[model samples]
Target chain A: MSEAALLVESLAYEYPDGNLALHDVSLRIERGERVALLGPNGSGKTTLVKHLNGILAGNSGSVSVDGVRVDLQNKDSLRRIRSSVGVVFQDPDDQLFMPTVREDVAFGPFNMGARGEELDLVVKDALERVGMWELRDRPPHHLSFGQRRRVAVATVLSMSPKILVLDEPSSNLDPASRRELADILRGLDITLLMVTHDLPYALELCERSLVLAGGHVVADSRTREILRDTDLLSRHRLELPLGFRVD
Target chain B: MIRPNEDPLKHPISDHHHGHDFGERLVLHRHSIVHHLEPQVKILAMFLFIIVCVATPIHFWQAFVVYGLLVLGTILIAQLPLNVVARRSLIELPFVFFAIMMPIFGSGERVEVLGVSLSRLGIESGASILVKGTFGVLCAVCLSATTPAREILRGLERLRLPNLLVQIVSFMIRYVNVVSDEMARMKIARLSRGFEAQGVRSWRFLANVAGALFIRSYERGERVYLAMLSRGYSGKLPDTGHGSAGIRQWAQGLLLPVLALLVLAMTNIWMSR
Candidate 1:
């Protein structure tokens, strides 16, 4: 059988200060599946996402992206995992560090050893996908928050990763920009794992939702079903918008 | 002041509407020949021109005049406004002040000009400093006016500047605005809580703010590093190919410096005769 797009088994992590951030967090995302990771602040969503790209190696268990295991000690495996699992950070400012948007988008593919026409095409395609091709030459500081977010997505998308993980993609966006980003994400064919506190956003974007609380997978079910479970959401500290009906 | 019904994050109180001005202040985007020249050539030409200006003696005032004229002519050709050049040259005001003080305080042979006593040697040396310093500043301003900051960094890289230093400078340029914006937001938050800095008594609060800004910036650096790693950045940054200058382009770019050199040579010949 073909491997799952991402597989995390009994993964656990602890910070340098001995703070146990995640424990026994096992999950599997099939290819092309859109999954929302719902949890309160400090519930280990970011930790899990970091493990997917081998940014933070788990103390125990294992993480595999596109069937390749994430091994921090193995440089080749780490590179392969990073390219296969693109993580779009919450702050665009952190991700888009290049002087111009075009160069920033090309940074990833260039590191992957792409050059000349191949690099140009990858940059062009990524920007076009995010509707940022017109503003390709502008600096990141000049772009609006929504525009920067889209460019941030493109920076990862340029690598053509098998799975795209977004942390708080809908945060700090206006209504129109929020809808626009949703449309863009919906159009993409890659597997997605969005870590968000925006419950409505999760319901709109993902078919499945995983609820994590106190370093554990408390719930994993359909997004609508999870949203409908008010008791479970309150228990996990996940709150929807006031008067947001799940019917 | 928070607007009603508007998302405060969406419309930051310290909105950077003039953020583009930070870059545009130095680089005037235009289709002029000077702006089109390769950045390395422009950088080299500016360095050569400054070197020649420094080498020329103060006695060669005519040569200085010609050098100034050459700069003015290039500014005209580059379509840069005379006022902008003059405004940027105001950065030399402190040096100008020091030069003026030289004539007043020097202990050399005294001379009187319009009821004012000045040392002859001090007058000559002061004039030299004024002329040389002005020429250096003008050349630098002209180079920056024609080339974008990114291009200047690329030029430095091509000129064999150490990769680590270049990356450090590049990151500094990119994050200066971000760090400043973060500070501005923090200030607004403080103001909203009715906090105000009132002289020495407020130093504690201000120091706390500074400390907070430092921590935020440090954390931001870590996140940026992680982002770089995610994109496959190893110890070294990848090279973005920049086309080298052709012979003709080099000749065109070096014209100003070469002309300055000729002016110096002619001044020497005339003085010898």
Candidate 2:
């Protein structure tokens, strides 16, 4: 196989208050792979994804993205790394921060110094990708929650990152919106690490799954294998949705 | 596990339409002259008037009257309901009123007024202060009611107000109501639990609530900042170009206020001499 897009060696993190968030984690993601980080509440799924973009420094282990080590010494490299890895935060309210949808989408490109027509093109393209081109003028506060979430995705997509990290991509989406998100995710060619509790969604979009429990990766295997293992899921405090049956 | 359909936190204050007529609340008619002026003109005029009012000595009673007439004329010309301005001004008046009362309690010459012995110097200084503060507050209320908050920030931006300050104010204006709504819901929850602050120990609960609110706000701010950064928000704010207070609008807006202030100043000068 080609070189891994991201490689983590014994990654660990502990909060200043002495709460261990992640412990001795090692994972490797190949280019263009779609993986789901599955865990119950407080499982350090978010902490691991944050390290992918250099947003948070790992306490012990090193994280390298496509051979570039994410470290504090290279401020310019960190910006470039963050730009290369688009993180769509779980909360739309947290992701869609601009007054208008168009501006919010334009923000990432603009920060990377894209200006004038180039920036406009990026904004329009990204908004169109999420089917939010028409709502470009509407304030995010006025949009439905699902629409806002789509705009949040557009905000990062405009940056054209090589890796897309989505936290709880389907948490608050309605059926129609979730389907739309799935379609969008399936169409994208970039490597993706989606952290979510939605088991069915993971099965539909991600081929591989990493199960985290108490800040440790308890199980990592093919998505179908992990889902079929009822005993492993119970140990990790994850349950299949009611009426969900795998034949 | 709570089914997706049955998340209690999703609908904390369920049925927002139950009693509140949000549509009616939003469609308030503010016909005040300040409202009609282009936002930029109103912002500039208000700023200038506030500066003059604040800088003028308390003993400059005539200047205060001119400022009052200018404000009152703007209110009448804008055709905004007087009751709205009066009601909104109350929020600001209490603080000034409290400050104005200090001179009354301080040592001063004794005098009789309405069969009560009061300090003559105290009343004089206090009355002057009351007049200065009232006109200032009225001007602010009229300006706010006339210009929508977003447009006000835009106007400030056009007036060359620091972008950071205007952006901060814009964010506050947009989010303060949201934060307040959250606090109100929290208060309702606390009330439903029969929690009441009775003593120092009870204040600990209040402190905890405050701490929780602060943490929530801080986390929200981080998310907001990240969102902003994601959207190409560098250090500078975007130029939306909605605030266009041109020369004609500026002329129309300033004419009456300037004329009134001029007439008042002349009358005051004549009276003083």
Candidate 3:
């Protein structure tokens, strides 16, 4: 594996309406590093994640996975980047577009040319990993929000990505589901880029974190260290719930 | 940092939630032979059966009787709910009523029945349409009632239907409920704030709701596409599951349509005399 699993240098993106979503954002995540991308809403976290897979090509700067640059306009590089860097969107419904859970989970693998028994094995392993194997044949919309979220993870996991990026993963999940997902996420051995507002979740699962505000990487340090900085957290619109403190 | 009770053991996302049957009404009588048949075979059989029924000349009235028996027998074999099927087929009521009107407006030779004059050609054409249309609707309802929407889409894809058309139908089946839920929530939000939607002027609000739904759906399309692209979707849906149907399965499914075809032939021969 390359030493620098993901590298973003001075990335800047401006929407068609002239609103800048990301500005001078630089990040480097080493291989096997579990890092949290913490930021407020509209803080360029998602914009930066989109650039990782070349989904959105910024106006300037470059993003590379495993040292190979991601050219958003090039089909071959974009395909390589997307296949290696799997992103699980916040809305499971948006990603789980296939008819059944099995098909949805198998979608990525099959798209990459997996067929028949091999595809079934990939799907089975992914579903079983997420504890959704029993419900593989079920339609996604029939499940609750919590169950669908797990299936969404399986959809990407089946691709066997080298880097997993989750956007707002724990939002709207119940406490039990949240804990369950955190555990599942921690157990996976891969480079993780989690963009989340849940500080407690970030503390539990991610060791390193970068705080983004106004489209810049304002702080990069240990998760615990960032949480201890009360002024930094507050200024970026992040908070710890009552009775909780960073020791 | 403030640590949670680090014991992941306390978190229990039980498997109980999957037990609830959401689409049971759509896939009722799941154990029936008809339910087990391949979706492509079922679709082809239904198409052929309807074609045979519609092509039968009105003079072959006896063929309609046979077609009706074939449908009723299949319904019984499939163990489908008669009342539900009949109620669902009520969608054809307006068209049936239109067929009923054909006798009145149809310009044809006049006939006297019970001291009332009626068009003879109108009676013949109207009755044929009613008989053919009702049976055709019954066959369709039986197919849908037995098959899940998912399998039907897969079946269409397997049968070499244009992938785009099949995908459109698949997305429609998947999100028809989601969009409706959004609309429902919007209505509830409006109602909670004391917006009564009961007047000629209320149509303006309804129009706005429609406009918002369209815009949201358009945006949702983009997100879904991005999601698809993220998963390496390259303008085509991969088909890696669902093998071709067995010959035995096809033979079993074609029995209904084949019997109907035979009825059509018999009626043609008899009416020729």
Candidate 4:
């Protein structure tokens, strides 16, 4: 059988302050799956996502990307896991730290030892994918928020990871930009784990969804069914937009 | 002077959108030989020019004239807007103020002009400082106007600047706007809640705002670090592998400095004669 794209087994994490952020969390995502991670404020969703690529190591249990275990002690394993599981941060300002869009997109592949024409092509392809090729030379600060968001996605996409984990991909975007981003995400064929509070967005993009609250997996089911279940959502402090009906 | 309706914090972004000239501050985004030259080459040449200007004696007024001509010639060649260069060079105003005070306060042989007595030696020294300072400021303005900030940092990197320092400056350039935007938002939030600064009493509140900004920035630094690690950044900054300056490019860039040096040599020789 093919290995799962992302696997977490009995994971638990605690902050440096000794506060438990996650406990006994486990899930397996098959290849080419689009999964939405849903939760309210401070519900360990970010904690779980951080563990996926060893950004935050849990006190117990494990995370494996494409059957390769995330080992903080092993530098090579960490590097491999990092490149395999691309994490696009919530703030484009955080992700696109490089001066120019092209350089920001090239940063990941360049770190991976891609150089010369190969590096140029990688940057070009990534920028083109996001329709930001023409603005590659523009500084990140000069771009509009939506354009910056697209470039942020390109920054990770250039790495061509096995699994792409996005933190609130649709947050703070205007309607047209939202639709455009949705179209771009839909066009790509890869494993996606999106952490979002945008219920309608989840329902539109993801088939399966995982709900975490109070440091545990409160619900794991299909996105449509989960959204339809008001009792299950309200219990975990999830709310859909007013007058929004699930068709 | 902020307008009553205008928040000073919101000025930068709006200024950016309204005028492309204000987007990158000193950078003019022009296409000229000066702009096209390699950054390190430009850096070295400008450095040489400034050094030669500074080394010249104040009595070499003819040399100063030539230097002024050279600067004017460069501005013409670079097609840089004269008003922009003049405005940016206003950064040297403090020195100008000091120079103005020199003739009045300095102790030397007295001279009278327009019913006022001033030290002759002080006048000469003050003029010297003003001339040299103006040239220095103008040269710097020219360089910055031609080259973008990122290229300047890259040039510094290629010139073997410490990677950590270069990275710090790089992050500063990238995040200055973001940080300022955050500060602006915080100020707006405060103002919306009817907070007003009325004197010494407001100093404490402003200090609190600064403290909050510091904490926010610190947290952002951590998040940015994690984001860096997530992208395979392991201590070493990845080299972008931009090509270095060739001999022809170097020769082209050095022409201005070489000419200025020759002018200095001639001025010294003439003075000795």
- What fraction of the genuine interface contacts, i.e. the true contacts, does candidate 1 reproduce? 0.79
Report the lDDT of model 1 for residue A162. 97
Ten residues in sequence with the least summed lDDT for candidate 3 chain A: A1-10
lDDT of 3 by residue, B172-263 (tens): 77776666567667766877898766556767877897799899898888899999999999888777455679999999999988999998
lDDT for each of the candidates? 0.89, 0.76, 0.86, 0.87
Look at candidate 1 and tell me the lDDT of residue B192.
Answer: 95
Of the candidates shown, which would achieve the greatest DockQ relative to the real structure? 4
Candidate 2 docking band = acceptable
Residue B78 CA displacement from its true place in model 4, Å? 1.8
Per-residue CA lDDT of candidate 1, range A1-247, in tens? 7899999999999999999999999999999999999999999989888898988988999998888899999998788888888999999999999888999999999988899999999999999999999999998988999999999999999999999999999999999999999999999999999999899999999999999899999999999999999999999888998988999
lDDT of candidate 1 over B1-273, digit per residue (tens): 332343223223234332334444578777888999998899998899989999998999899999989888888889998898888788788889889988889887999989999988889999999989988888888888888777887888888899999898778778877887787778778779987677567668767877997899899999999999999998666667857889998999999899999999999999989
Provide the lowest-lDDT 10-residue window in model 2 chain B: B17-26
Order of the predicted models by lDDT, top scorer first: 1, 4, 3, 2
lDDT of 4 by residue, B54-115 (tens): 88888988988999999899888899989988987887887898899889988978899798
Q: What are the per-residue Cα lDDT tens digits for candidate 2 across A167-211? A: 999998899999998998898878998899899999999999999
Error of 3 at A24 (Å): 0.7
- On the 0 to 100 scale, the lDDT of residue A132 in model 4 is 94
Q: In candidate 3 chain B, where is summed lDDT lowest over 10 consecutive residues?
A: B10-19
